[model samples]
Target: MRLWLNRIGDISLREQLITQIIVGILCHELTPGQRLPSTRDLSRRFGIHANTASAAYRQLESEGWVELRHGSGVFVRTSRPNAPLSPEMAVDQMLGDIATKARKLGVSDAFLKARMRRWLALEPPARWLVIEPDPELLRIVICEMEQAVTLPVVGCGFEECSTSVMLEGSMPATLPSKVLAVRKLLPTGTELVTLQVHPVAPELQAYLQRYMPEHSTDLLGIASRWGDFQRIAQTMLIAAGFAPESLLVRDATKPGWKRGLDTTTAVLCDAAIQHDLPAGTRAIVFRLFDEASIKDLRSHEENLTTPDRN
Candidate 1:
């Protein structure tokens, strides 16, 4: 049996082996009751640790894709008696067809596996947990995501998200900048989704384009508890030809954050902190998730609601 392994990618060698073998079986390249390579042979051929190969085989066996014979070797399971096609079989067929089409299009196995990982990551979790170190940003993310997804959305700091929450099958999401830190806090196999920073909303952009040149010398105050937002807003403003000196950025979490915004012509802040702005302050609400992100989120929610055939 031939197995493709991606050593430099996020997927472990064991998982790569298991996925490939399953694909092989589903594609009928490996017939039922066909003997598989020994763990030692697999280890040698794939240049993986012997233990990794053994673990892959063990997982395949536990999943009923293959069976291990004591003192002998592993083999694909023989056909069961008069059993209907299981969900697992259906999934395999679908995956096999996908692989065939992708191969025909000259797509490499590594690229296909990477795409698979991305889609798998999109699978809906039992709940959406927004992980933000700042309480205000956490609240903003939760509120925004709640509007975008139908699932229960909650917020927590990095430390507040305990192992129990992860064990409950929560999908922890965070800003792109904070993903690495969040991933380090989660258990292995936990999926960490990154919320993308979007450009200023279209209406806001239009307003800026229409009026900014007239008020080119006016101060543009930008406030948010999310550092990413502050930075993204600043970058976008500068890219739009707004003078850097005309921009006043603030981290709302800091003391006296509102001290300098009073002289600004307008303020841009996240919806969660909009209420904290001085009364009568002209504010343009900046959103983190854009239309594309929202569409992707809707797809994820659909995937979550779809019943597993297995």
Candidate 2:
């Protein structure tokens, strides 16, 4: 539906699912005592691998967020702090948006083929990261996303020594199992792309390319509405193996505040610029990384740098 998932930060699909269910239960979108879809059904519904769906359920159980009966199905057991009770409203609005997009396609056969081709050509990703210039509150959400996606993230810190943690090449020899997701940062002002993530959607790709700005990592030039961005980010995480942590949102909105307030209500840094800008003005500097597309320019043996120790 109109996913309340924040598109910013590096989250995995598992994290987003957990957030959705938790928020769903807390906000009454998913009623308490109602049975959840089996992990198989849920996986199909969410386009997730079944095993991953099962893991998410287990995580929810561990969190005391839901209860699993022998065969009765999973049930909501708790409400998260300040969770919205507007599930119905959110769903309605989300469906409306989906309808609008579908209608825009207008059943064009040729247009549909191109869209399908794009989807088919895309590869499954393994990692993602979101580095907000104002790193405080965003860090919390990033941490949650790492947990949700079950993938290690980078650039969460201003420190450079942790560079090895990135899926980047540590050596120039050997073959790696996969290419590392790398953020190609330029040294010059606007030439630099500060945020090392993927763009929300291809639909906004043209829009993003138009923006000329200076940064440490690339920023999404798409300029989509905040709500749309939230969805895109959620989708990326889900695809990359992370999920958003909606339950962690802290309502930082304040009346009469200007410039830095993020209207999305996600726990954003106090310097988010939403509170500082002119009304209707917003800035989104995030995208997800599809590690599969990376090239191993280094020795594969030492390429991963920090291989999964466990």
Candidate 3:
């Protein structure tokens, strides 16, 4: 498995590895009995100390997530049938689970109690609150959601999500990349929807196959108000064998950002701002979400509005 580790981040390397492994297990990406990368391999590949990798694997084993075979490598713990639970045992187990989740979210006992009480009194979600770090990406997500579902869709940046009032009566949604970070800031028992991002690499490759021969020397433009999108597009193009000099990147956030984009053969942009490009400029629109995610959002809206007859 490929793991991305930041050596300079505030979180320790061992802890990061543990969290990522656990997340993979929970997401079903690491299935039961799957062998994990060896400590020596992790150390050599990631440039971390061997001791650090061993410590992380040890912690995971202690937490019941993996098992260390004496000679074989560590593997995910297989599932086992649970013993029958009495009524009182079941209740206690449920409460314990709640406490554990709350602690992870940094909620004090008092705050948990207060929030639980308030949640019991509140009605169902009236809208979606999309949390994204980039304002341009936020607008794109909100626009797509607004089109897919009937409920109102609003958005705020990561900094703005700190205000608790914004979460009231709203279902929180974010990109898959931000789920872990956003979950930490949410209250216990809050359900978060991970918005799906469209897969663009294949489309990019096809574009290259179809157009590269004729447009080899043409100046192709990558336009987006979001810096990350532009950077990612440029990287993918370069990796696909496009010459860096033949690419023109325009950040829509700057003044007169569209002034020179009309000169390019075609401008690749996110769906939200495609119409804003120069009238005659050809646009290769890359939508951020696929149809399946939009269908899921629509189903969620239906469930929320329809009465639970049962």
Candidate that would win on lDDT:
3
For residues 1-310, write the lDDT of model 1, one tens digit per residue. Answer: 3444545423466765776677557546688999999988877876778999899899999988999999989999887667667899989988999999999999999999999999676645778888888876678878778888988888788787756944366777788668878888887657677776554466566755675443267788999888867865665555344666878888998999998887888998887788899877898888767778889887876776787777
Model 3 agreement with the true structure over 1-310: per-residue lDDT tens digits: 4355654423467876886687567546688999999999999987999999999999999988999999999999997768989999998998898889999999899998897789656678999999988788888788777778888999987777757788887888999779989988777667898886654533554686775443267788999888767866665555334566778888888999898888998888877778899989998876666676678888877877776777
Candidate 3 — what's its lDDT?
0.78
Worst 10 residues of 1 by lDDT: 1-10
The per-prediction tally of clashing pairs is 0, 41, 0
How far does residue 201 in candidate 2 sit from its true spot (Å)? 22
Q: What's the TM for model 1?
A: 0.49
Clashing pairs in 1: none
What digit string (tens of lDDT, one per residue) describes model 2 on residues 50-132? Answer: 88778988999998778988777777774456656598988888657755676686855566557657944544323444433
Task: Provide the overall lDDT of each model, using Cα atoms, as 2-decimal numbers.
Answer: 0.76, 0.43, 0.78
Candidate 1: segments with Cα more than 4 A from true spot: 1-90, 93-126, 132-139, 156-162, 174-197, 211-215, 238-245, 260-263, 306-310
Shift in Å, residue 240, candidate 2: 14
lDDT of 2 at 285: 38
Best of the candidates, TM-score: 3
Candidate 3 residue 226 Cα shift, in angstroms, is: 0.7
